[model samples]
Target: MKKILLLSACLSIIPGTTLAQNTTAGTIELDMPGHFQRQSVSFDYVRRDVMIPMRDGVKLHTVILVPKDARNAPILMTRTPYNADHMTSFASSGDMSSVLEGYDNMTDVIADGGYIRVVQDVRGKYRSEGRYVMNRPFRGPLNGTQVDHATDTWDTIEWLVHNTPESNGKVGIIGISYDGFTALTALFHPHPALKVSVPMNPMVDGWIGDDWFHNGAFREENLPYIYDQDATPKNDEKWWSNHYDAYDLYLNAVSAGALGKSRGMEQIGFFRQITAHLAYDSWWQNQAMDKLLVKEGLTVPTLLVHSLWDQEDSYGAVATWYALENVPTSARNLSIVIGPWNHGGERVEASKLGDIKFRADTGYYFRKKILEPFLAHYLKDSTISLPARVSEFRTGENIWETASKLPAPDCASECKALHLEPGHGLGFTIPGVDAGAAQYTSDPDHPVPYVPRPVLTKGVTGSPWKYWLVTDQRDVASRPDVLTFTSEILTKPLTIEGEPLVHLTASTTGTDGDFVVKLIDVFPDQVSAQPEMGGYQLMVSADILRGRYRKSFEHPEAIPANTPQLYKIALPFTNHTFLPGHKIMVQIQSSWFPLYDRNPQSYVDNIFFAPKAAYKPATISVDIRNSWIDLHTK
Candidate 1:
């Protein structure tokens, strides 16, 4: 259950409350004890709760807020699995004039743009009636009997236009994260009233990237993540772990299945369903939002907002953007904005990431300048124009740029290989061919921590994992298990403005392992005085490739022990300029604990089922002469 807080003096309960947005950047705060000590935002609106029946006859609990002095207004709707209560600011009382607070607290936006806002709980979640299936696949060519998110949204909008008082025929949908994914599904079969959708930071895929798994490796955070999402049905609390050091808990448990079993995941259907399909089988692929849109194509305009350092859903943002390329320009109207943010951090205070300052309030610019204009132009017929097709904030330079498309086609030709030189160096110019390789012994018993801290802070509302993307790396740079390759200070700035990749020519003594390749920016030594800025090693782009899935995500194959093999790990998309004095660095390691489950190193068809006894120390080697990182530098 969401920890509820009533407006009062001398008490605040915003610490552990997670919002429907689910942004890793920061938690939303409901200011208690205002000067007036009012319960909710002050807006003269009529509020009512209605049960809208879906095509399948499942009644979806919804909240409708209409302005009392309202004329014709566009209907802005959002369907969320996080429940609709958060959207409501307050509940109706004996005094009808009393205002309520809600998750869709866009009362200001509604008042300015003249919108009839509707927030709904999706089927099988919270107040909604029907079986809940997470990331439900799109059931296209719907015969009246078949149902999915697309049908549910379509049916809800159909009922809203005719039933809701003061609602103009025009409708627009918007949401972030899981709610954002639902909004993406609605575009497939948009009702006539639906005109625009802004699915910001959508969790498009669970198997490849975003939320559940990343590159075939089961996310270690999944255990606690599910606990916070639906822990109430089983009479459990948000946190499943009683231990302070969460990393040690999962590390001691060994395999993913063991962790799940220890937590009584047998009682959770989603956990069993996820563990059953370790591979990216038809079950996960069919649920991909991009694949869903391919069939029904976007018939309405979409504005995508993403964070360059989005801890959770960056992969979904980039993948979904490209997927729309298959559709015609006219039908698939899409525009995107990538800022220096973490998860939904784009909407929060985004001036700095970690200690590095971007020098401007990017989150403020996105919301006030970008999102506000998009809604106005599309829904309210405002004269304000939409932003360029792609608007990305360049990090090192601290500036924004616009292009016809992301990565700007010209970047493909500018791709250059920065070879890993001898003596822990990075350079574009190759030195004399070297034969020796860097060796590291990776022990599952003493796995490398993703952050410098020993304890893993676990909570959906306030987690240390949320800011791990921007955490400093100096602590791990000296470790024997981590390989650090740095480049000489640049005479001129090298701007990396697109996708980066790690091509490791290596092998492990064990049959199975994971390769975590990270691209970091090492600050100049003179910057070592201030603690936060002191010789900071900031990780820009990084990713992992489970060796077993190198051959195929669908077909698992073990690595041939003591043999050189090429593994291409695609890091996330970034736009950072390596400053003149800074050095480009790459760190390679076998394990990133707590962030991802530790690989057993022993060959198994499914690592989830692998036992703790199977885990052993593996000597991994990376050939300096053969290995290189492909940085898309301009």
Candidate 2:
């Protein structure tokens, strides 16, 4: 009878049924993708490309996809700064009835044959009208007439509700990366119709986290595309370098200026901006989302989604979610869904990451159970139980866990210090472990690659970059420049949840340098079940720190030569279990190659403007004092 009821409930949701199913709260759907594609169930949503006027009179390009049969359907929207030129093809050709094979990837599961879906090109990008400021700051308490992203979102939501014929007088905004920032800005100045927003891997602070920068280091991924705007119409959209080993290309640049001036890389203007502000100063503070969130407080109910292994926005994901930490869990309108994904894992099949199989179709589960349900409950008033305030996926022990708060409030969780001992051993604190210090010379010419070069073939294959965190580290583990520390075999599984941090007591021979740290799980040397997995060293969590910014990110200063400095490299969010017989290892290095621009060991006012001559080798020593990683585990 229960099985029959569940099936009937699903059938009732099929359009044209009045069997009446509860949709306003708890729902458990059969996680079956095959059942959803019977007859293909292709649905037509009227596509309209119109100009949405912001309060300031700037017209923005917006795509309105309204389901023909579903009248008064709730509107779900995504606003992106990225080019929306392909969408324009929908209305321009007047072939609206023909299915959008590409866009349908999202429409299929999300639109579910019908929901008023809207996509808009944010101001200043593509065909949108208005000057685009990357990561426009949230204007606090707009004076009715003030204009900003906050007001733009509120105004757009208002216009959408009244203009879209079938809009149910309610709107929900969603975006990834930059668009995610726009969604977050909407919460600051919400419209009456704007009920909810999901900001996935949004930019939090330019100086610290997200795509452009990590802490104070400049991220090289987007630099190729957003280069000095020299990319003319005649030039293709291949933003990354053409060299087979772009990793080595950027590494050799030494300074941002060196890279910018050569090979037409100068067209990338942001390269100079990054070198100008090495600290979290006015340029970044004005746009920092964390500061805005603290002052404005997230008033609207929000769902934050990000992967534990998100290469770009793990910092933003965890920082944005925990920023609302002071707010009571019950009263908190902020909810999160952390999965074993890299970057946009929520959109992937979810079962496997590179060579690591998650043993489940994690992506399908997120889309069917989590993503679909959350959007439906809030936007369509479907009876569904939203995910817990904190929904985290546990890797190694593949399962999703929920609780009132993340880092689970359970007694089993706490910061257990994994101390570094002499002879490269990792264990709980011993009486006098400081036996002196571990030392190495970091040569700029021989910088360590963030991942094995063979794995970085995406540049040639044109495959999207993903899952670098899960890349096996056995190749670089034996490098002379990398400091490797290992713990004894675990007798029982050691499950950890939440952010892990590595605190190092070190000093560099030069005035400026970078410290790279990796938290790894080492499989036993001999594995009977899977010999291929033998000695597989998977990187769980890792981070890097610019030695100059040891004291403050906003006020970077040269490291006093030969002086022991404390560098705390806080890693990204992670949920994993170090199974019995497995070993826990932490590896420390100086450079991460082209993934991040190498730090010139010699400190100059701005590292980017430094000449090639400034690049030099330096000896780094990490002493045993209070140097250890604080792993939060259950």
Which residue runs does candidate 2 get wrong by more than 4 Å? 1-43, 85-105, 139-146, 228-242, 263-269, 328-331, 408-413, 431-434, 454-464, 527-529
Q: Encode model 2's per-residue lDDT on 147-252: one tens digit a residue.
A: 7887777777888888987867878887777777788888875787887888887778766767777777777555664552324322344555555676656765
Q: What is the C-alpha lDDT profile of model 1 across 224-267, one tens digit per residue? A: 76755654522236556666677777777777788778777667
List the lowest-lDDT window of 10 residues for candidate 2.
95-104
Q: What TM-score, computed on C-alpha atoms, does each candidate reach?
A: 0.88, 0.86
List lDDT for all candidates, in order: 0.78, 0.74
TM-score of 1: 0.88
Stretches of model 1 off by over 4 angstroms after superposition: 1-43, 90-112, 140-145, 231-237, 330-332, 408-411, 460-462, 528-531
At residue 106, give the lDDT of candidate 2: 48
